[model samples]
Target: EVAPQCRTASAAGFFAVAMYYQGADHASFRPLCPAIVEPQHYVREEPLFSSMAAGERRAVRRRRLGWFAHQVHQNSRTLIGGWVTGLFGAIATVPMVARILAPRLTSQIRESMGSLVRPPATELHLERLGNNPGSDPESMGYSLDEMSQIVVRILQDIGMVKDFPPTIVFFGHGSGSLNNPHESAYNCGACSGGRGGPNARAFAMMANDPRVRRRVSQLGIELPDEVRFVGAYHNTCNDDVDYYDLDLLPRSHRELFRGIESDIIETRARNAHERSRRFESAPLGLTPQEALEHVEERAEDLSQARPEYNHATNTLVTVGRRDWSRGLFMDRRAFVTEYDPAVDDKDGHILTRILQAAIPVCGGISLEYYFSTVDVEGYGCGSKLPHNVASMVGVMTGAASDLRPGLSQQMVEIHEPMRILFVIETTAEMLSRIIVENEGIRRMVEGNWVQLAIIDPSNSAIQRYVDGHFEPHLVSDMQLPTVQSSMRWYRGQRDHLGFATIQEPESDQPMNSSESNASAAGALA
Candidate 1:
């Protein structure tokens, strides 16, 4: 079936050749017989295709296409069309083109002229910024009641109700890579395959609203007046973070906010170093800056195969408080969503919301990566190398093949094919109810699309949900490699390492997971 079919029993520009075993032919031409069952076996020649994938094929194809498209000048129509358009525009549209570009040109010129002196920071005057009346359905355009509900729910989930952190950073995630077809797949799962930075920004803006704060007070979730919400975007590719609306932060909190820059730097470096271990080209024993530089360059490199493995080895989705796994080094695999079952109304209202959202988004991403890794040809686009961005819709193997689906081979090569272990901090009964209520979520659970774990709100007991019932997850207290920090753990190791706990650098500091949990619990109580 892979070969083209023959027709009309003859050819002018084509010839046919047949190779068969000596025992295969029948006795008489007029006599008919059933086809032979098996081959006696003879010679088999090596195929022309090397199975070279992704960047290799892309490098060769890009050069050949470049030569043909540019040096060879094959597409004369497009070149001549450009030339004709330019000439026509020059002859007739000087004023029109200028008019079109005037505002943009003026702005660019003004900015360029002002570049000598340092520009004062752009002030985010939220106090003066009036809310749009028609944007929201609420009478005030900003509903404090709804805002308080969302704010309180989020705060309670993270286990920081009474003792609010001076500056809480919401790190909405997304990825960056070059020549990758499944780039959007690496972005914030909750944002409908878009960048989550804007969503984070909106959430921060809502949290900082005084009007919303007053409403929150009425609801009994008293956020300290001094506490601030900072929205940030975490670049999953290189681990670089961009803080948004920092100028809006009160002047008193400016120094405290500035202090977080070092932590961000540390995080980026550590994450970059950890990721660099997976890449074949990255040198061992590298500093943070060097590691980050390599990754940044790797993403831009046209020939590099894996530009940051998107969600590879993502097996865990811990939906309890961040306290349970705060210092646990998950190799950038776990989706740690915060949710506190104790604070929410006993009907599993908040737990339902968290599970309903996280299950589908995380499950879809995990399953898609799993299937693609399992069967690249059947379930995924074979390699990004031969893929042409067809009409900016989907990719194609060649000019006339069917549009390929799912992830490319490069993205999922290291992905462990498994159902996502969704750890929720709620009762088993509550989880059962939530699953039964939402048909889509129920399909995910009952259909084995996602495995659910109901963590007891008060303790470390994790109950696994399977076949419409819950059983305790038999956790093995296995001995694994120990490291002080994530960077230290993954420093020189290339292969996958086992689970680990974050060892505190200082003796007086709190235990990574337990101490934080204990403090948060005490404060909230």
Candidate 2:
């Protein structure tokens, strides 16, 4: 049923259209629907019929009738002209009039229209001086005091600080090779006083910035005595320069320093030896089975080392083999279970629960996932490992609150997961052969026995996995061609790749027997 107000408004609109059409130009207006009566019915009959006197009255009557007829003809022309004019006026003015009255007519429609016309959200604004994109890092932007104040405001908004403060950490990165001009002066001597170079000066400037200092104070974030910075080198020959420059940062930045150092060391070590020989030679990977065993053993060792420290701590550990073919025959579930036992406990259970909840929100489980693969032969670490690890940590930290109330409350308190990822790159032909040559590995994932998510950033065999019933996803940015080009341009540069989490089936309900039967029948028949 139509709303009463809607009906009334529509009637008013129709009436307005009729009135406007009546006043419009005659030629422009035509009857939209057929007229029920002729024009003669509309003419006035009084004055023309008034003459009379007996026998003369009859003659008078005849004259009066003729006059009346002429009058009727004239009036008909006037009425027709009015109708045409009104029609054109109605047609021309309706849209403009509607727009003018729209706001008063429907508040909800107005709001929807406004939103439809609005632009996308803007990025965070940086308040700085000068147009120099490449200014001396220390001298650019607002003063250190200003930065501190801004930080304070952010902390206040987040409710992280009600005058409560947290420790502050500064991580830095730059090009620092023999080829660069400022290679020798790794630290910001200008920031520091004469006792050091700009290092202290830089920190002092940052601390002095009202915005920065206030934010730091509000967040209760304290900066350590040392600052950590990572410098990139052009070649392996310049490794020494990169190493020494790293020490220039404050001692407080030591932890940050160690992490980057460890990554570089690991990447270098991996690159030095042959892919086949490295596993066989090192105690870490003696055999294909042993390598798989090592991953499980490492998972346990790492889990034990960290433990579930508190209600807030979350952990993510990913272990991939360089040679998946070598472990093709190995039982994936056996290895995953042995290696990552924690996954079977509370964390895994909660993750599964969250997935179930999210399914309704996101529509379905056939979402795409992206993965990366890097050439192990290269001197630099590939994008796959770092990207996966970072993404996992981000998801755990970012979505912690959304998963559960208790988890959300412990968001800041929880320790981020320690991630381990592996990457291997080979030609397309070789990859195709590997899948055929190593059916065991393919079956491990396709059989749905292993609770793991595999992403093919390269997109090579990713479709095959999808076709085989494994939820393989392609992250377009991580495709082999793109990654290779990136590596070539920025070999030593640190870049984040993409990653997706491995989620278990959300519900305990078994697959429908009918659906399974249909699928089986379709396959066979």
Candidate 3:
């Protein structure tokens, strides 16, 4: 049913996606559903194979490259003397050779500076987030009746009935930057992109096991011996949170884990003053403790060129109920998935696994930021200001050609290339039998890549999806301006503004946004 001009992933919207790197289950990032099928073997069983192998499907060619093992532990005269010192135009001795041999190098000078930058990995010191013994994939780790039918089917795919949320706090997002080569495409795309802190420290050690909470209250779903599933780690690139099991949290839930870590350190300083209004050397109206110490020193600035705009204007993905995209404004551009579509009455079965994992993880992160912001030098892999992490798997520019995978150009230059609207709730005949029984959610609803819609999880009847059905997406009501916070409706505003009905959020006074103004031309769905 797709066809709003083939939805996007081409004509400069990128997604040539050929994906491999299977095993650690993100099962090769769906594009032609990993060449036909094996959607995590319908919820896991060590997928030795289900799809990917018609001579192993191909296409993601940006000159196939993948170095890291300490970037080919250098040789060939220390990789032609660091490409003849980046072509004799030394560029200010590359940040003083990236700050004094980036911490006393040697594993043979870190395989000669990890062949020109970015190699740090250590620190897993996991004291206890427990249940380790053989960490089963099938010697059968998941059976207390398969972890209570995978915790009552992910609490009926996020609708959650009988108990939880006194302190469920799974959070588990991830992404770090420095010399970013799409840092595992800024992680947590259902941990295929990886780092959802060991799947939220292994689902808070299998929902605080007492034999999986007595097989999740013998499947009636109750979980509350002073309910405590913490395991955190937000860092959705520098928004930084971290918790993880806190030695199995319960001294009667330590004052509800110190009031949910002071409302997540005041929502990570109002999400770093809404990502320091898209960082122009941050520091304006400061205080969310000076914009969380300027985004914890721009997540340790390796010549910081926007380290934290990781998902940059991600564009509305609402699965359902943050009571309908919360108090209006969503400039931290919505990916909100709570889901409650009346717990599936019309057989949408948790709205078809929340649109089969939010239509390829929010349409593969909005067609990989709308083809890396509509082509930043051939589907983006340009600009991280003269990138060179050539061997540590990807990114290459100064030290030769080829090996330029997507995302860069200062991370899709403020990114707004569109295509992901996705807004689901339920209906339109249970979303057209989940868009005619999934051919990978009908090739992302017939290649309009992602735009589908629905709304009414009992009221505001929106609709959208087109060319092959559903309609009424009209909008027009009024009473906008509300604020009391969003740092006083974007304190010292930078630009792109819209949607204001805030009514609470008070770091002295601020701003979903049917977002427009980042210099509006489109986006309303």
Candidate 4:
């Protein structure tokens, strides 16, 4: 009974080590009984060899570092003199280099580069204007016409051109923590690890303008006079939502805003409750309000290693209407983007724009988590327990070490390392064309860096893209458990919970006879 399982486990471990050594970047291993250990005789000797190999690699790394340090110490004077000379030479040639590159360094070029010489690289925490337009007038901000277009595009993209809500809240998300050097890791990736509140506030202010609204109406998407746009910031670490420009709110809209605020308060408590399940320090029996308070304290605590698991366990990105995924428990593992194919042109211009940002950003985040989780010491920055912020440049181990570029162990402790799955609401043909045309998207999909699937907008059917072709995915017949509320489903659980539908008392459906019989049989057994 256990021999096959032991063999499978050994093979899986061997394959994983082989894949790692061979540089098979995308390979993943799943053991049949990962938590169970076989008898010593049942285990294989391959893992011992792999461990020795790992030790050798570590020794090699240490030798290289030692050699560099020895050279630096022996030739300190020569190296320092050479560095000084080079610095001075570069300073002296700055005028010449600037003059030579003057023609190439145009205002348009600078604007395109986000007014910086180098592009924003999240690995180094460099800030950029991201996909959304920023408040910087010349470099990142947009004109009135551009803002109107953005408004229309947002509406059309989200399938909200008609039936506009009275008060539309644009919520920008960021994190809050005390005495955490890697605080930026918890902020919005779209904003280049900066607070996104300003972006949301700017967009809301622009959309609320009568002039922008007039132009948008001329473009065929009319906003009612009563419609108002409100900007808000969500502190993910503390689970708090704060509204901006409330003083500018109309007298008539006060009641509506108040109701929205109430709903947000309730949502914050529930969200905190869901997130609290992952924290060992948090009690499983905590109420929603208690969970909220617990998370709030975590944000403010100086000793909190994990203000929150930033992007951990992110497995999928779904680009489509909210209706398809509504009422489904996502377990906070999916990034949902609003896109309406019905409103898109045949050329899929809107979809293309969305993917241009979505594919790279989401894929980058997923890959970062994947690598960090797979080899925490080698790929990741290692444990942040002894990390020190060096001169505000980056994090270093102990007092001095190499600047760690990847995530910390606390951030990726619970992450499941796998290539991210991208589910888009579009036809297979459109997706194929997208994959073919966009070089970045092509490399990611074709190279198997990300898994692709298209969901039919008409019937909500899914077709996975595999080996350059779309294969229809078989829908499962298994039913998700039902509960009256999230608390009912999550109560007394301190580990990962499966999906369960929350329903009102009246709408809760009774289990079918077949499932009931199966349950009875299992219980009896």
The candidate that wins on TM-score is 1
lDDT of 1 at 393: 83
| TM-scores, each model vs. reference | 0.71, 0.19, 0.28, 0.70
Q: In what order do the candidates fall by TM-score, top score first?
A: 1, 4, 3, 2
Name the 10 consecutive residues with the lowest summed lDDT in model 1.
6-15
Candidate 4 per-residue lDDT, tens place, 1-525, comes to 101101000001110000001011112221111122111111111112324555445445656666887875566469686686565666756544443344224323434753222211111001123444332322233446766876776666556677565677777677877658888877766545555554455556667889889999999898988778776678888888877667778997787677557656877898898899999899888888999988877775555788898678998888887666655666778787777788899999989977776777678789989998999998999999999999878999998899998899999999999999989999999999988999988999999999999998878788999899999999786688877666777677765567777563331345432212110000000
Clashing pairs in 4: none
Q: Least accurate stretch of 10 residues (summed lDDT) in model 2?
A: 7-16
User: lDDT, candidate 4, residue 511?
Assistant: 41
Cα error, candidate 2, residue 55 (Å): 99
Task: Give, for candidate 3, the lowest lDDT window spanning 10 residues.
Answer: 5-14
TM-score of 1: 0.71
Q: Give the TM-score of candidate 2.
A: 0.19
lDDT of 3 at 141: 34
lDDT against true structure, model 2: 0.26
In model 1, the clashing pairs are 157-340
Best-fitting candidate, scored by lDDT: 4
lDDT of 1 by residue, 1-525 (tens): 000110001000000000111110111111000011121111111112332243344445545655765742444357776676566656555543443345334334544764432222222111212343221112112334555665665665554567565666665566776546767766655544545554445457768888888887787878778878876777777576888778688997776565455556765776687788887778887887788877766655445567788677788787776556656777767776666556788787767765655677678878988899899988988988887878878888977789888888888888889988887778878888888898878888888988877778767787888677998887787576667677667667888777787674653433333223221110000
